[model samples]
Target: MSKWMMIILIRNREFSKDMNGLVLFCISVFVFITCNCDEEETLEGANTCIIEEKYFVSKKVVELWPMRTKSHVFCWKVPPRCTKYYIKMVPFEVEKKFPEFRNVNGCCDGYKKVGDKCEPECLKRCVNGKCTGPGECKCNLGYSGTSCDEVCAVGKWGIDCKEDCECNNAACDPISGVCKCPPGRIGKNCEIKCPRGKYGEGCLNDCLCKNEARCHPESGQCICRAGYTGTICDTPCQFGHYGEQCALECHCSNGLGCDPVSGACACPPGFTGLYCEKRCEPGRYGEHCKKFCNCHNNATCNNVNGLCICPSGYIGEKCEQICPGWSYGDNCLQTCDCNGSYCNHITGKCNCPKYWIGEKCDQKVCPDGYYGPDCNQLCHCEQTNHEANKETSVAVASSFCHKHKHKQTRSVEIKILTKEERLIFQYVKDGDYKTLANKCAQGVNMNIADINDNYQTPLHLAAKKGCVFTLLTLLGCGVNINAEDSDGNTPLHIAVADNQSHICTSLLYNEANPFIYNKSMKNAYQLAMDSEDNGIKYIFQTNRLQWYQKIRKLKKDEKKLFLYVRKGYYGSVGDLCMKGVNVLVANVEDKENTAFHFAALYAQNIVPMVFTLLNCGGDINARNVEGNTPLHFAVMVGHVDATSILLQYGANPFIENNDGMTAHNLALESSDPSLRAIFNEPLLSWYLN
Candidate 1:
């Protein structure tokens, strides 16, 4: 038999070995040969072993008993018994257990290796998504499908598109289940409407409605309130129309309209009641009967302007003056039928003289010593003096009586006198004109005062008693006309206190000191100012006007000031007033119209003139001959600024002119609405103050 040797190539590696090394080596050789043999065959007995590398077809790796312990096996074509020949081992590099290696044949940039394929790789982990390219992700935000591209149908979403959406009257996102609200709605589920005064989408727009109007939330359209019309409810209803879209027509009378909001009729001047259908009642007149009538003598009052409609045989603004001359009856339109005699202004009855008697004063007088309506009663002239002389005198009738000397007897009776002041005061109080005359002729002091009666003289007594003849007798007797009583009141003061206009006139004409201040610190004119008697006020007003006129004559600057005021020259008037011109001066040619009156009548707006005159002591209420004041003239000429200025300075609007028209009355009659509006303003008291 031939012997052969075999060589095996093995990698150098670190492994465990047992004490029975040959056993492991024999087991390793047996498994290696068994794995390397591709075919089974039986070779016969005597064969020669040869080292033929041609039979070493290829190298194959064979693992040993321990892991990573590898060896190279070569298949040889030797004899079947060649397995028992040489076991030569060749050393090679050892294989490492874990090693770092460059990925030369691995997946590119953003890809990873998995098993045997190059799969896509993403830097961020895909959630509900898939990696479609290198570092690329395809997300399924609210969707689920094979490709993660299909949206969840209707109300389903989630991992497998199984969750339902929750939304009300709005759109909902399938992935998140969040709702989207529409216009005029808000809330998480879009279930609430917008609040008041807010409109449009998301309730973000503000409504433009005015005057407490309403608006639609979605469309933002305004709904107007009652008494208002127009877009945004800004305009008021037109005149004669009122209430709820201005659909109702006004039913007011007297050519007036109703309130735009309430539909209530607004009454005009001199009218009142619900629909302004009634006239003002008696004793009330002017502008819904707001003003009281100032008429006297039972006269009819004008409802519109508070003017007095005078009755028969009466004249003047308040119907306070009786008709003059021979006229009588209504409006003094009828002439008296009495022939050449004093006719009664009220009744046309003739007042016959001493000897004549008839309806027309055509009949002769009654016989002497007998006096009656028809000359039938007996006359006793001596008996009238009996009661007057009994207590005051001791009559010596036998001594003064003689048939041839009757005139001397009469003179002796007239010469009877008394020094008693009480008796003389009694005569004046009783209107005993003849007794007072006799006392004056007898040299009894007419100025004597009774001690119990404020030390007042007979002149004061006559004035207090309103005895015109007694006052005249005292004046003729040359009694002290300006004599003051114990209270320092003159006869004129007493007359004014008693509201005796005629007595005041007589005392004033007789040179009584009307300007004298009494113990009450009031003069006659000042006292007259407190009286409601127009006659007494007129007397004092006239007297003061005349007195001021006399003072104006003494001053040279007055005429120039008057001329300046009349010509509406405020600059010249101011200069003149500064130079001590008398502002109280009246124009006699113009029936006592003052400088203030002319300025008010002529100027367009003389506010400076008003201040100048008022500052210089001009009378704002001073009346001219026609009873018109500065306010009257100012209103008559339509001077608004002048009127406002005068009102601010306390000008009285209720003072009437000759026609019984007040400033308010004139305003009611005015055509200019702005001028009329001045009186109707709610700030009228503010303007006055």
Candidate 2:
């Protein structure tokens, strides 16, 4: 058996004629060998003549076959018989010149010669390694497998991944086996955790936790402290809850809540104890009892404000002084009932004269039946019918006087105001008409008085203070128009005395009795006349004329409507309007002004009155005697509410009064900014312009 070599050649026209003969002879040899061989059977120890492969063709073959067709040519290493025949057939001289005709050696396609023997080869290169054999690779360190394409698996390193990685919680260098600590780990073996407030790879990231919270070493996740919960631990626990993540419930009592962080109870004013369950101890008041009490003489101290409550036989805020002038008991409200001046202020016991006896010392030696200082003994005595009747009549008269004295003292004494009365007086004194009106609407007695304050009723107080709105509110509440005070003075008298001309006018308009005399035997009109001030007197005169005119000009229904409107009696006004009373008719008493005109004059019930009049088809711009519209009168009086209502209902502010002044002109002349502000509204701005 013999291994044989195959060679291929082709003819080219570019070759000279002498070379062409050699090409033709080689071609004839190639065809002869192929024709002599069996088509399908293998020849033992014999190579096929057709060696057409797509690899490594010699450069010389390409040069010789330049411009040759794409079809392949074949050559074979013929057997000895064929070679002998071919040598005999070809010229000996040509065979001697072409030495390649003897033998040619080469690997098949996709192979290169290394030494003597040809081996199988790979055409494409291997990555991370060298090609050592056919489709085989020799990989470098840290790489393995057929093509050396795979890196070492985790915890492995070195050639073919033969060495194990010596690292903890880290990545290992594939070739060096050096430890690479992951986020939040350090040290040579990656066994150490990152320092506090540091996280992430190499501990380079700062922790985002707040409020003394901790963060995860690796993930930077926040761990909140007690009483805090949030992504960054910035939020405090909600109310009624405390402790870590707000998971704990609070058990505090009588307080808003416990401290959000420590769950400690926080007490309010006048309270103490762990859970604020106790009030301030006696004589110690206010927050935590930090303040000292100023009370004296066995007075009770208030727990909240440290106010002193005076006991019996005591007077003054701190009970520092004893009741004087035969007065005793709580707040010195009790009087000594005794025949003698001397008495125990604490017990109200009379120090009877030598012959006098009994609690009040009314008995002269116990009269006929009773005896002893207390008159607790009984004694027999003879008496006639006339004597008995006389004694009985005398006793009855004494009893009556005693009861009358008590009643009179009680009526005039300074009284502690009730809660409702206190509030009512405060409202009246402050001239808070809105609150007072609300209280009146809630069924409060509008005529209530503080006897401590001269028994002045709300009306008297309002008149004295010259609170027009308050006075109007009281008047409209159906209080006694002429209620007498302790001084026997009426509200009219008070108003006249105080020189409140407007209040006097209001009182007179409400039919307050000007003729009724006070304790000084002076009537309201006389009081006004007595005053040095003429304004009050003028108000009275003018009010009286108006009253007379109002009575004469208005029909019964018109009178009722006018009175209702003046008194802010909207219900009555509504009733009258429903009865078809002419709301447009002008009243002579009100300067020939319509009901709407009076509404502008008086601010009380002005809103409802204006609405009522307008709803009844009253002419909103009706001109009074002075050519002054309702808008004109409203601005003239500087009535903000009235003016605003008129303007809102589309009152023509451009209408000229008799003085050639529009409502806007009147507002500009007035000192009230509210009136000008109403005129300057965007909706009314155009009218003024």
**CA lDDT scores, all candidates in order:** 0.65, 0.66
RMSD of 2: 24.1
Clashing pairs in 2: 49-76, 227-243
TM-scores vs. true structure, each candidate: 0.29, 0.35
Per-residue lDDT of model 2, residues 378-399, tens digit only: 4333443322233333322122
User: Which residue runs does candidate 2 get wrong by more than 4 Å?
Assistant: 1-168, 172-222, 230-235, 269-272, 279-497, 500-689
- The TM-score that candidate 2 achieves is 0.35
Q: Of the candidates shown, which would achieve the greatest TM-score relative to the real structure?
A: 2
| Residue 48 CA displacement from its true place in model 1, Å | 64
